[model samples]
Target: MLSEKTVKDLIDNALEERSDLFLIDLKVNPDNKISVVIDGDNGVTVEDCMFMSRGIENNLDREEVDFSLDVASSGATSPLINTRQYKKNIGRTLAVKAKPDLKFEGELTDVDEAGVTLEWKTKEPKPVGKGKITVNKQAKIMYDDILEAKVIIKF
Candidate 1:
């Protein structure tokens, strides 16, 4: 059986060569099928995935233990799983699904160790008038409360 630690070490070595890259997830199924998902501070490229794949394939002895490796980047629409991901996405609009059946769609204005701040405008009825007015609204959501968050891409 191929060891997960061995695979992880190879991935770490590859990341050492590229400090901007970070590991998002790693899975080693019972069949020795290894899946590695990575992300970068700036972004991931096709070359980055190839580099990571070679890093693992070149180091392993496939003859001794036949194994398969799949290296891929976190998809553009994938949910944000790391704090660094949130930091990189600052200023972008995010559709956040939070706890207690709450959802928010706003520009990610800030990111801290604990959570993020979203700012957006909504139409609200005026205090002394019949017509509605635009009002600026913002919320600070804790990381624990966030069920999922994805960058809302706009054409």
Candidate 2:
């Protein structure tokens, strides 16, 4: 069985050669199956995945380790997992699930070490009018408040 540290070292070496590439997740099953998920600032391409796969394949001795590897990009619909992911997604629409049965959509305006700022619209009653008016609002959401968040694709 290949150690996780060894696998990480191999992947890290590959990423060191590439700019703007980050690892999202890495899993090594007991059956010697390794899965690696990666993302990039400009988005990851098939060639990038191939490059990472080849890098690991070349570093590890398949005959000795008896392992299977799978490397893939964190797709558009995948949930944002870290601060880097949130930062990269700035200026994009996100579907945020803050709590059970609580969800909202907003434009990600900014991200800091503590949390993210979102811009959204809400309907409020006007002071002198009978009808409600649309009001643009901004909210700061802490990282702890988020259960899941993903970029909303607009066609």
Candidate 3:
């Protein structure tokens, strides 16, 4: 079986040459099938995926170990898995699900290793007025509180 570390080293080497790229997920099956998902600070293109695939292929020896590799961008629909991804998505809308069935949609404002802060609008009663008004509020969500989070596409 092909080791994940060997494949990761190759991918890391290739990524080192590209400053914007980062690894999202790497999976190696018992049958020697490797799936590598990557993302970028700006965004990843099809050409980038092709380039990474070719680079990995060039480094590995097919005769020594038979393996199939699939390199792809962590597409728009994939859930956000890391802080880098959240930082990249700053200013974009995200649908976040938290514990105890809590869910909301908001614009990602900031991100760090600890968590992310989101800005959203909600209806609240004004202190001087009897009627409710729309107010912008921010929420800080820790990584542990997030059950799932994905970018919301606006058409």
Candidate 4:
């Protein structure tokens, strides 16, 4: 059996080489098998998994050890919008899904480790007729208040 230090060193070196392409999350199961979840810049394709698996296998083989390994992308429903996530998406808009299927379109003004600060657009202006004036309003929404959020790409 390969020691934990040996395995960690192998994984760290292998992953650090491709730091720009992917992020690795390593875990050890109760049975001592290793499970690695990889977060790629884009979605993880089969080729990526094969390449990573082969690399890890070759490294372990060199060290002469028997250990189980799994390589996979995040496969998360949504990217973790932690402080890091927010910082990465700075100056970009987002589509926020709130409770009860309510959605809000807003621009991300600030973000922290705990949550994001969203400034929802005020109400649309009404026609300047002989009737009512437009009511422009803005609201601040916390990250906890958001159910789902994704970057809104603009063409």
| TM-score against truth, every candidate | 0.96, 0.94, 0.92, 0.53
Q: Could you give candidate 3's per-residue lDDT for residues 1-155 as a string of tens digits? A: 88999999999999889979999999999999999999999899999999889878898899998999999999999999978899889999999998878887999999988888889999998789599999998889989999999999999
Query: What does the lDDT come to for candidate 1?
Result: 0.95
Candidate 1 C-alpha lDDT tens digits along 1-155: 88889899999999999999999999988899999999999999999999999999999998898888899999999999999999999999999999989999999999999999999999999999699999999999999999999999999
lDDT (Cα, tens digit) per residue for candidate 4, span 11-123: 67766776533544677665558776665554568877777777667776744555788888665445544444556565667778876667766777777655666665454
User: Which residue pairs clash within candidate 2?
Assistant: none
Candidate 2: RMSD over Cα atoms?
Answer: 1.4
Cα lDDT, all candidates: 0.95, 0.91, 0.92, 0.64
- Candidate 2 lDDT by residue in tens digits, 1-155: 78889999999999899968889999999899999999998889999999999989999997788999999999999999978899899999998888546687999999998888889999999989599999998878888888999999999
Please give the ranking of all candidate structures by TM-score, highest first, separated by commas: 1, 2, 3, 4
Which pairs clash in model 1? none
RMSD to the true structure for each prediction, in A, is 1.0, 1.4, 1.6, 5.5
Q: What is the TM-score of candidate 1?
A: 0.96
Q: For candidate 2, what is the total of clashing residue pairs?
A: 0
**Best model per lDDT:** 1
